[model samples]
Target: MAGLDWQGWLTIGVVLATLALLLWERFSPDKVLIGATVVLAGSGILGVRQALAGFWNPGVLTVAVLFVLVAALKSTGAIRWIGDWVLGRPRGEFAAQARLVAITSPLSAFVNNTPIVAMLTSAIEHWSRRSGVAPSKLLLPMNYATILGGMCTLVGTSTNLIVAGLVHQQPGMPALRMFDPLGVGAVAAVAGGIYLLTVGRWLLPLRRSALQQATETREYVVEMLVEDAGAMAGMTIGQAGLRGLAGSYLVELVRNGELHAAVSPEEALRGGDRLVFVGATDAVRELRRLSGLRPATEQLFKIDDAGGRRTLVEVVLSAYSPAIGKTLVEATFRSRYNAAVIAVARHGTRLHGKLGDVVLQVGDTLLMETDAKFLRRYGNRAEFLVSNEIDGAARVDRPRALVALGVVAAMIVANTVLGVDILLSAVAAAALVLLAGCVHVAELRRSLDLRLIVVIACSFALGAALDRSGVAALVAAHLMGWAGSDPFWTLVLVYVAAVAFTELVTNNAAAVLMFPIAVSAATQLGVQPMPFVIAIMMGASAGFITPIGYQTNLMVYGPGGYRFSDYVRVGLPLSLVVGVSVLLAIPRLWPF
Candidate 1:
């Protein structure tokens, strides 16, 4: 502090303020990081070129391209297909946990773990209902598994790519290979998986899920029709995956004008059969994703011209509407409003029977399927009081799923085997998917996570400031004084610091902030920088003690009915297990 210059003090202040703002959750991460970059560049602490260089970094561009690739795969249903194939019916909780770790850990190595977790959360909820297992027991472990898997490959997580990009910026440093972290990551993953399957399983709470709680309050009645050429036509109700739906139950089945109430699980389903379900709103939304089943109303197909580009919206009927007293069929609702009503609810009471036969009421809430533009078109119209589009409701293109899968495989081969750069490989894959019609340009634009890209690009300025202002070296000197300058002890301190920063800030930010300190520490010890680099990468992703530590953790917090203590109860042990394994393995793999 005595010898510090103005630039060093300014950089330190900006970094501390950034961490405080992020932890306070006052603003979005992108906004906070961008503001810090502006401050540094404006104060002459960093040049304009250095502040904006992150926007053009190879790692940042690669992350953006990968987002498009993941969106294309999701739109084509390839990721869901893989999940279904690998998660074939497990008998019990332990067996389910084992199967989940096996599939998610490996799959996340090749693809981004965030989308993988997002898609699987719903799938796991369905499985929990069918197997009579509480979702709270499975969701947290699944989140941890993805985080562990992400440590295996460079493309597995954004943190790894950001660290690699930093490494590439150094003089005389070789680029990191795809499997550079495999030795230590694989060992840590194995150790973490074992703890989850045994001790962590016992510690998980058995609280009711959010869907289960919602079922107790509000319920909606909806009907789904089986297609003549669909896969579920000849199967029994149980075999068709409709036996024990979570927060929903089958009321009856109608075939050729014959009514059968209290249908049995063994009852066979036939083409053109109407199955009535009474459940919560989430259950209805989940039913929409099932193959071979559609809303009973034919208007659903007639309203949206864009195939696989529709969303579910909730609209409340107002007294000024013309169809308040007439039935949906009599009012010609589809032709009049360009939307089809799939389900209706009135003051916590569930309506039953065919959607067309139901008479519209002034206060009834209607769940309709229409094009994405329906909200923009009719948001202000007096025909509806309130209109809101459901999130993650877009339809998938099953026909082009295989084409999207092929494109992803080709991208991996090109990067790992053909010796092409990852940025080029990702660009080519994104282009191929667009050309093959697996995902539309508009849909891709809507799905791209621009906020995440901005945060990654803007964070480079903070890292560069720390280096140029000598703050990183000053911190490294203090760390060496405390650790007695022993390479192993210094490595431990570096790893511990990274883990702490990640839990307080974010994974990518922790990596960027710790990169300069790690390099300075390695230089002071006269050791290869590779060990310290790998340590930072592993520690930054080992955020398991808190939900806010990782995005995936927060994603499951509500759905799993988890409290903050639940994470500590289950995650603290997992953090130690992974930490010990990584610390021991890094030294042997890349000696310091």
Candidate 2:
């Protein structure tokens, strides 16, 4: 065995520190990753090019392009339509989960799972309300199903592409075909989905939204407008999906400057009509996203051009605030604060008439759609007791919806059937969407998730350092020593180790770091590396036990109001089921 060199020791130390700090969760993951990358480069453990190569890696760029493409699809309403159409109202929660699995499985195979989850989060929430299912019950399944779906195809997740990249790097190793991993991946997904539907549903945490969480404040009053020629225009209140909404009521309607008290459910809505609703904050947020309904305020339009840069912030009035004693109209919130109030929540109090006429008081929580700079400008001010930005909802562009769908279809066909390079196809598809008016040049920058991109890029440096310094080989030798020379058991060890690392680190990082180690173990055993490689790919993406392990898990974390234990309760078993399924199927499908 080779003794540990200085570079190997340094690389090991850096990797350990990064893992420790990540578990601490005090700093951003990107900062920690970049810091480690710089350390490896500065210590001469890795060349500058090797350290920065991740930034230009095809895997990283493919993920970035897919993010933008998904954004175009989202903003154009393509994803929403697909969700509604495929996941038709099911009679029960189990059926709803099954429907979601059916829809997400196929879609995620062709698209990246991050945007697939992002697009489905809201749709699932809405479905839960309409179908009497808890969002908690459905959301975790949605995330898991998407992860499972990603395993079925080479282009499904960035992790798969990273594995494919490594496969291409090894001399004499054939490039992975698009469907090379499909058999094992598909089996695992189906088994995992079945597990979730039966045993997993009972284990899901029944978390209530913050709005409904407190009995002291059961509801809040808000207003919405019927858009011109929208889904709700000319429809009676009963027909506009305003009736029978759980824990919500359409209280009144204002039209032509006249207040119509307790407007009958039979009254048809017009473009100019203002509808008053009494509901929990969660329901009102869902209302904001329904097709053809918008906030009644004209101020929201002023900042719509900012693209995705705008966010929703919760601001509480303080006793000393200048706006506390005045109405929102009198305070000129849009002008003074550079934000528009979308909704307000006050304790057990009923708000009457127009939102502009409501008098502000200390402790009133205002839900405002603010500019990117709003939090920085007002976050610390004594005038507001609290100013925190929350997740803003996605908006749809009806005009460009079909164009986005067409571009996605073309990319899938060109890559899978026509044998075009996946990266080239993705780039072309992204370009086509932008030119076809599905997304604008100005909006393109906002679509990228820079934090995810940065972390992924830096992980390449870490992976290279591990490989070049012989640390991966050292670890593999030790692992093989414990596995007793059985290649199949060694494959299981590789998979379990990858899964452990994935739960601790990011999925892409886990895959990148494990690829060399898996190959080394296979080489040591004098067996084919494809089984170990396939194991790494499956295990790395199966990060179900924790939110930090996967982006999609965190995406649904806050929106679903999930506790950390919630994920563990449901995801732990799902992970085990997937692991066993993958282990049983990989060797049969591809003998070592």
Candidate 3:
């Protein structure tokens, strides 16, 4: 107390205000953390190098590189393949959850959980459509599974790597190994997994995703031809994952000029077989992305070779349109506009027969496959009243999937077996992915989550301010006083504080802020700092009670259509299970 200075007090105040703003949701976390870092840097509490050091931190750079690596995997269909293979044809919801947790946990152990969640969210949604399970039933469990998996390894989540980086800076403190947390983290994951699969499963509400809840105002009848050499050519309808589609149904299958209505799930698909589907706009959009299928019209091939640069555009025919009364075949829509009408909807009515025979009318909405430049060229044209590109409808490079997977595997081997640093391994892997043409440079740039990286980088500045200003020591003294010289109780207090901070702020920021205090507490007790450090690492990731607590939680929030109380209902108990398991295991593995 006697050593406390004005700098310490200012850092404390700034941290409190930052936390308040974060909890208040007044601004994004990057802005809040950056604002606090600026204040501390301006006050000379931290030098420019220290304030900006996080940007160059190995952990932060590794995170950025991993984003590109994951993007490559996603772009090349490696992730979707993994999901489909692992989550294969589960009979019921329980089996689905079990399979999901089984795969997500282990995969998340190596990859960053954010992109994993993002990629798998869509996959699981599509799976739900086919399996007759509600997305709300699966998304939360999957999110939690990723969090639990993240705890088992240092690279599993950014929080663990950030803490390890902070530990490396401390004199005499040993750096964390890849599997240092495995002892406690594995136990906690098992316990948490059991709870989520059993009691937690029952606690989840049977809800629909935002897309499912929306009314289908524009139902389009789309015809897709099975490609002769594609993966789905010889597979049964059910085997090809076309059996059950949410908000959409197969109306008929046209084979050899014969119409097969009420298509059976066991029907075998042949090359050039035309499958007709009636679905809402969202469902149609998803259908466009399916592999082994193309728009049934030959006009699509006549468009200029956009190749991977093609996108889906939705436009409403205006009264002044030249082909308002003409059929698409007569209008030569593809040649004139350099686009193909994949599907069309008129006044919410399902148009039957061939798409080319449909007469264009005023107010008809046409979903067209066109060059990426379509929107910019036609946005203000009188021929269309509305023109917009469908988001997330990009061409996937399935051919390079194996290359992306191989690169990831090599990176893991280099990092874990060959004694290379994770940042170098990640950089090499990302580079290899680009060099192999798994993902384009533009896609790589877009995949980097700058907001998350900024929040993490700026958080290091706050952590530095806490350590440099002696606030960490002061807080350590208070923590010791609260624990009354008992190391076990002191460990409990540190873990509790970490969990509170994580739930209130964020996983990365919580780990950063708590690192100094955990180390200081270990120092004041004359005990090994590793246990306290491990406590902070595990505790910071145990945030399951609030959506705002974790990025993966928020990612599923809208898609799952969950209430805030939903997390409380299921996550509260799961948190207790994980916390108790971690607290009991940490002291044994890394003895104080």
Candidate 4:
């Protein structure tokens, strides 16, 4: 250690500190990564060019472009159609898991898996209620299936592109073809899919969510108004689909300044009647979408722009929320937040009153009708514990769906057949979507996950620091020495190392750090680097053992009501299956 150069030791110190912070999980991943990058650059361990190089990396830019493309797909209803078509009504939980894996596996091979999981998570949450399946039983498998599928194609995951970019930096290494990892990756996907279907079902626990427990304790009391022009006008309560709504029931009907309690199921609903309901959040959510029904308060109408587009957002009031202790009307919530509360639910408590008269309280979950910018505007504020757009809140533009699909198809062809550079093709596809109005330029800001982009870009900087400071070479040499002359053990070591590190850090960071080591290890063994490269690629994505390991896993963690150990129980076996399959298949496909 004393013999090591200052740059090498500084790089090692910075990396170790960054790892400590990431493992602590006290701060955002992006903040921790960017902070580390700045420190390394400021300390003179890395030059400005090297520290900032990741921002321009093809992998980072490509991922940014893909986000726009995905948003376009979602805006046009293309993703929704694909999800519904692929996950058609299945009889039971096991059948539903099979359907999801079958569809997402192949779809992820061409499309980025993160957005796919994001798009599907909410839908699956909704479906879980309807089909009597626990989201716990479906979400983990859904996330894992996408990861396995991603392993099969070059463009499947940003991790693959990141690794390919590294490979291009090496002299004498040929650029990777689209399906280079397919043979091994597909086999592993199939093996893991089977294991999930057979063994994972029993391993995953059936746990009700906190929201569910809250609902069971007490139902939210909400008021809805029947609009004059809505098809629901003049229908009986029973005929309007308000009777026996899942998790909800009509409690009162107010019309012409008259209050009718214990309203009969057969009571006819008249235009402008204020119907009161007691139900769970899910039930309330369904009620909000009912045609001709509007929130009793007129503020909801104000959220609609001249373009007539509206989005539903969930805002969790914190101690700092301005509306705390103030009634919605008093807060002037419409003008204040630029959003209108359609419904409000306090955990395990129910309130009775007109919508506007109910005073806001800390910990209340307000469902607002607003635009996409709502997330960006209040997401980082201390006033709210959470501010996020509700997935599937808006109607799909079915007319634009085909055009979005065509643009995506052209992107695939341009990269796979026409040999256009992946980054350029992605940009061109993104432009086509924007120009065609699949996704408007105004919509792009919130559509991209800046945290994801920053983390990837910073990971590139860290990788550069590792390579330039010789830490990467030092680690690889020691690893090769530890494994001796055995190529098989060397490959397994690389894979195992990646999997272990990924559980502690970002998936792309794990891949970035391991790529140089894998390449060096192959060079030390006097063998082709492709096998080790493939091993690193597959292993970096194999983050099933913990929620922190993969972005998709974390995305579903809270929503699915999953504990940390839940992942180990179900994911361990699948990880083992994938590990064995990759080891056995990699040598044959990309021989050592």
Best by TM-score: 4
Residue 475 displacement in candidate 4 (angstroms):
1.2
- Rate residue 67 of model 2 by lDDT: 75
Candidate 4 residue-wise lDDT, 50-108, digit = tens: 88888888778888788888778766767767766767888888789999998999999
Ranking by TM-score: 4, 1, 2, 3
Q: What are the per-residue Cα lDDT tens digits for candidate 1 across 1-592?
A: 6667999999999999999998765466788999999999999999999999999888889898988888787778777677666567988988888888877987888888877876677677667766889878888888899899999988989999999888889776788878898899899899999999988899998876544443332345667899998888999998987855654556557789765544566888999998867555566777787788888883222212223444656566654467888876588676566665656665324465455667876546665655566754664354554454544343456778888888888988888888888888889999999989888776677567777888999999999999999999999988889999998888899999999998888899999999999999989888899999999999999999987787777656655667778888998999999999999999999987
TM per candidate comes to 0.73, 0.73, 0.72, 0.75
Report lDDT per candidate. 0.78, 0.75, 0.77, 0.76
Clashes of each: 0, 0, 0, 0
Off by over 4 Å in 4: 1-3, 217-394
**What is the Å distance of residue 464 in model 3 from its true position?**
1.0
lDDT of 3 at 249: 50
lDDT of 3 at 304: 19
lDDT of 2: 0.75
lDDT of 3 by residue, 1-592 (tens): 6687899889999999999998875465778989998999999999999999999887888787888887787667676576667667889999999998888888888777866776677677667766779988998999999999999888899888888788777888776677778888899899999999999999999876544442232345557899999888999998988744654556456688765544566889999998866555555666677899887764222211223444555566654467878877588676577665655655333354456567887556665665666644554354664454544343355679888888888987887788788778889988888888898876666556677789899999989999999999899889999999799999999999999998888888899999999888889899999999999999999999987677677667655667778999999999999988888988788898
Residues 1-592, candidate 2, lDDT per residue (tens digit)? 3588899999899999988887775566788999999999999998898899887777788787887687687567677677666677788988888888877986798877866675566577556655666777787888899999999988888899888877876777888877788999999989998898899888988765332232233245557888888988888877877755654556456688665544555788899777766555666777876788887774222211223443556555644467766876588665687665645555423343345656886556565655666654665354654444554344456668877888888988898799888789989998898788787654566556677789888988888898899999999988888889799888989999999999997788899889889998999999999999999999999999987677677656644657777888889989999999999999999899
Better of 3 and 4 by lDDT: 3
| Worst lDDT 10-window in candidate 1 | 298-307
